[model samples]
Target: MQWVLDHLGDISSLGLQHIWLSGVPLVLGLLISIPVGWLATRTRWLRGILITGSGLLYTIPSLALFVLMPLVLGTSILSPLNVVVAMTIYTIALLVRSVVDGLTSVPEEVARSATAMGYTPARRFFGVDLPLAVPVIAAGLRVAAVSSVSMISIASLIGVSQLGDLLVDGFNRDIAGELFAGVLASILLAIAFDVLIRLAEHTLTPWRRVQQGGGT
Candidate 1:
């Protein structure tokens, strides 16, 4: 408690950095993956390629990718952009499949009815498909958000600051309190983001609640 109070300023700064690092990639990845995933559905041939490529990208060891990003992106080794780029790739890899699955899960009957009612492809997509797809996409976002929070700790390996720094700093100083603080902070951050995602999901999917209420 005393240690935490003493380090409160550092903890606040690092926690905010963790949020920014994780949140930015999640948003950008979802934006990019939605269109790419939609295009994959339109061009069936591209679907396998996109999924496979993203899977391959995700399989790269995180530290190795961090090391590789500077060379590929021409950023300095210590730059936060490297972490952002790597995390964004990981976020896209995970969410593209989620997007594809969500879109595919939309009922064929709904799609057909929309078309029969003179809905253009774009209008149908915006009005019907995307809305129905939100629940599944939100599920993916929740998982990605939690994963990103945890992974930001790895960025501290390369000197990108965040709550992960607490672990590094603690280990160097051999202060058990700092090490415990880091672990607890990471867990709290993950849980906080998860709750926020669930709230967003609930907001976006009022019909799910309606269905449950009707069933009850």
Candidate 2:
């Protein structure tokens, strides 16, 4: 407690950096995943290739990916971009399947109704399909958010500073309070991400609330 108080400023700064390191990749990954996911739904062959290929990316060890990012991207070893790119790849791997599932979850009747109303492919996707798919996509986003936060800690091992610094520094120095603080902070950050995603999901899907209200 005393250590946390004394280093509150440092912790706060690291927390903000942690947010940056994790948040940017999540947004980027989601943007990229949407199109790829949509493409996968367009045909059987594409679905097999894209879903399997993207899913395989997650199997790569996070540490090895982090180390390789600089070589692949030509960024400096210490550059935060390496972490951002690697994390984005991870986020996409997790989300593409969710987007695929969510889009498929749309009722066939609803799709037919949209088309029968003369909605174009683009219009139906945006206005009818994507909006309805929010719940499932948001579930994936929540998982990505929590996973990104925890994984970002690994960046500290590679010299990128964040809350993971606390863990490394604490462990090296034999400071239990600091180590506990890092663990606690990471958990709290994950919880915060989960809550925010849930709130966003609720806002985007008012129909769910309406259905629940009507049922009661």
Candidate 3:
């Protein structure tokens, strides 16, 4: 405990870097995914290709992909930027599927009544489809956020000083404290994000309350 507190400055910086690596990708993934998912729903052929192609990419071993990214891009991904790109691609894959599923889950009458009321296609999506999809889509972000945290731990191998550095340092010295501390911190972070997402889901899904009250 003293060791962690004694090096508190170093630990904080490392922790902050890990957060950046994980968070930047998550935000980027959500933004990129919304449009890609929407487009996927619009085009049947493109839907299959995008989902299958991204799914294949997601299957690649993370370390292998990270190590090879440099060779493919002609520059090493030994930087935060590289980690961002690598982490985001896999997350984007899962999120795109989630977004597509979320949109599809909207009640058909919502779309039909929306159309009958003279809402333009664009209006319906932004005002209706997107709002309705918030809960499930948020559920997807929870998954992606947690997964990205785990992935960012590996980013230390490339050079990002993070809680993962604690793991590596602890491994070399066989100091169980460092390793466990790092792992514990990571679990706390994942849980914290998850709780926040659930809160957001509840706040956004007011219809859930009415449904529970039998359409009060």
Which of the numbered candidates is closest to the native, going by highest TM-score?
2
C-alpha TM-score for every candidate:
0.96, 0.98, 0.90
lDDT to native, each model: 0.92, 0.94, 0.83
Candidate topping lDDT: 2
Tell me how far the alpha carbon of residue 143 in candidate 1 is from the true structure, in angstroms, after superposition. 1.3
Residue 84 of model 1, lDDT score: 93
Model 3 compared with the native: what TM-score? Answer: 0.90
Model 3: which residue pairs collide? Answer: none
lDDT of 1 at 165: 96
lDDT value, residue 74 of candidate 3: 76
Model 2 over residues 2-35: C-alpha lDDT tens digits?
Answer: 9999988998899999989989999999999999
- Which regions of candidate 2 are displaced past 4 Å? none
Runs in model 3 deviating more than 4 A are: 71-77, 210-216
Q: Which pairs clash in model 2? A: none
Candidate 3 structure quality by residue, lDDT tens digits, 78-110: 656777788889789779888998998989998
